[model samples]
Target: MKKLIIFCFAITLFSCNSSAQKTEQKTFEVSKTDAEWKAQLSEMAYYVLREAGTERPFTSPLNKNYKKGVYVCEACDTPLFKSEHKFDSGSGWPSFDREIKGNVAFGSDNKLGYSRDEEHCATCGGHLGHVFNDGPRDTTGKRHCINGVALKFIPKE
Candidate 1:
């Protein structure tokens, strides 16, 4: 009787734990099919925005850009980050200290076997990049490491 009770408890515990891992609730203002995304986005943009692929370091022109502008989502043209918050983190990506409020969404990414906070366009559900703590300590103390291909820089003029 004691052995059966322990076995039942173990089964229940395992079931609960596995169910938690499967919950990934995703919702966005705009959604599209694969073909629609491919038709609208450039090849490189599609890979990073739709498939969450990373661009090579120092490869994006935006990494060296210092123009005053708004960085928008290539997929849905949603305003994401402002140039005033942009910073150079030496990470070979377009780094920002903050994003426009309510335009971005975050999720837990465990693809690398560890949890990472992945950013996405709140409107289109497009993958943007990840955020980190290693940023200018003087400011908001956040490093929004975003991909260049995933964005279109619209100058403030």
Candidate 2:
């Protein structure tokens, strides 16, 4: 009975550990050292992109931008979303219905204790934000909630 109890305890311990599973290391096209990233990005941008942090809601000026432009990764200038796909998600962050295909990457984020689909730049692996199912029914139902600091808007010329 004691041996069975020990085995069960060990199983439960490992099951609850988040680090028990090994994550694959991804290589990005625009790789930079920590010092280089810090020197290149603003404080908030570095926080959101490199540290996987979130900017305060409604604080991003890009949240209300309605101009026609392409949103590119601030770190590597890789186009990630088009202005046409942008919409007012009312979630205080820049929301997009779709991505610029093959320029963005998706991964599972479980930092909030629950799993969420996270989006990042494929070129630099910068943390943009989480994607949700709540979006316009007429378009793609995926709401790509992104941090404005992680992006640089390039107005159509």
Candidate 3:
């Protein structure tokens, strides 16, 4: 009788653990084709916006950009990062102190076999860029190192 009780409890615990693991593995899917993406964005925009390509540093208009507006995804026009969160990290790329709530997702980027946090658009699952821990103290202690070409700044009127 004692052995049977222990076996039942172990099975229940294992089932619960398996379900929890499955729930935690949820991820967004980005299965759009290049043609589909290009129909929504310009040539340059499509290259950097949906293809996860980086633009030349110091060449982005947003680098020295200081406007009171929202920055959105250039491809899908989804609101991702806010202008208030934008800051100069001196890395040449546009840096953000934070992203719009639930607008971006994170994943382990072992592309070069080096571990780094890669950021993606939560809505379309498009690769926006990587994030770092070094950032201003006024906002969240995170540096959302985004590609400038991936965004479109909507200046506040």
Report the number of the highest-lDDT candidate.
Answer: 2
Q: How close is candidate 1 to the true structure, as a TM-score?
A: 0.88
Alpha-carbon lDDT, every model: 0.92, 0.95, 0.81
* lDDT by residue (tens digit), candidate 1, 1-157: 9999999999998888896579776767788889999999999999999999898888899888899989999999999999989999999999999999999998878899999999999999899999999889999999999999999989997
| Ten contiguous residues minimizing lDDT sum, candidate 2 | 16-25
Q: Poorest 10 consecutive residues of model 1 by lDDT? A: 19-28
Query: How big is the RMSD of model 1?
Result: 2.5
lDDT of 1: 0.92
Better of 2 and 3 by TM-score: 2
lDDT of 2 by residue, 55-101 (tens): 99999999999999899999999999999999999999999999999
Predicted structure 3: lDDT: 0.81
Deviating ranges (above 4 Å) for candidate 2: 1-20
TM-score of 2: 0.88
Give TM-scores for every candidate, taking all chains together and pairing residue i with residue i: 0.88, 0.88, 0.75
Clashing pairs in 1: none
Instruction: Give one digit per residue, the lDDT tens place, for model 3 in 65-156.
Output: 99899988776677998888889999998999989988888887776779999888887767788999898886788999988888889989
What's the true lDDT of residue 42 in model 3?
Answer: 71
